[model samples]
Target: MERILEPELMDDEQHALAYAQADFVEVNRGFVDRFRTTFPDLTRSRVVDLGCGPADVPVRLARLLPALGVTAVDASAAMVRLAREAVQRAGLGASIRLVRARLPALPFASSTFDAVIANSLLHHLAEPGVFWHEVQRLGRPRAGVLVMDLCRPASPSHARDLVETYAGGESPLLKRDFYNSLRAAFTPAEVARQLARQLPQLTCRVVSDRHWVVSGRLP
Candidate 1:
């Protein structure tokens, strides 16, 4: 927690991010597709979505898997508020509950969830070890945790340039926001190395384009 980015600040960024990525249907679908393909046995499991900005994942999951219950959590209060609003608007108020809480110190009990997922949340953390241990604690003994993060750039400068170019004339604030996200990204190998050392029981893999997925039944 001490080493992690302040969720309070990042949460505000997340609210803005929902609009920035509002049309990112491909990115959102990519994750949903991958998770289903990766875990076909999962019919309607209880799911926990970490760093669930604007409540997108939970809302989507509940739509895709009507039988499942999804709990979305984020460190940002504003983001959680947005998430709750979104869930309620979707008429899925009973299916998803958005909570304002930081990762690596989850409020739920052990074996509380059938599966846990994190999207673009790992790199913002300064102490990923705490993240692994805490998420492990919340997971069912043989349940899964799906993780997605930006692949560290081959060249930081190139990445920055790409972000600036994609960030068409928003504002200095918006431009800085995109740049910070790229800077905070972690490479697939780097993520694997870190998880291997901390969450030895989990398996980490890279998906198409810009995402990395880490998951396995906890030992």
Candidate 2:
């Protein structure tokens, strides 16, 4: 199936509020655990989180590693506002720095970070290569990269079933966004093809029932 493009930024106040109020602890905690396991002994590392919505994962990660410095970047103004509030609440104001920058065009220097991670941000891109290219451009040599996103279901029925099963507790508006995001997501095959054609150095794999994790060391 062809990919559908969704809004790139959750700048809308209602959308941002829904995202901030929504419970994503399970997913965010899992991401932090996965990152810890994957990059063991990464103390005092400088990491960049692209498309960090409300500073969820980045805040969790900062708590996990107090020495770690995180540059959490998002394109949405509302998200940035909420993220600042979250970081302040988490008392990680010193560790996690929030930046309002769009993907594929970060304001940082090339090859500047020790690691780069993006969670569930791929499907929002109409041109996925721009993100992949930025990963290489911003990551220093041997920098770890982890890009995870939802996998598009084989059929629309499956997508709906997923929404009902996983997001049944969410409000109707949030569920609607989830369903649309599923439709916009790329399948594992499509992601693999993009990896082959655009970022051969990185590896892509299905990490969960509904997620694909693309990760490797920058070449």
Q: List residue ranges in candidate 1 displaced over 4 A.
A: 1-8, 13-21, 164-172
RMSD of 1: 3.4
Error of 2 at 28 (Å): 1.2
Write the residue-wise lDDT of candidate 1 on 52-170 in tens digits: 87777777778888888888888876777777778878999888877788766678988898888877777778777777777788778777778887665666576676665565656
Predicted candidate 2 versus true structure: per-residue lDDT over 1-219, tens digit per residue: 556778888899998898788888888898888888888857689999999989999999999989999999999999999999999999999999999999777899998899999998889899888988898888999898888999998888898999998889998878988888999999988888888887788888987878989888887
Using lDDT, give the best candidate's number. 2
**Candidate 2, TM-score vs. the true structure?**
0.97
How does candidate 1 score on lDDT? Answer: 0.73
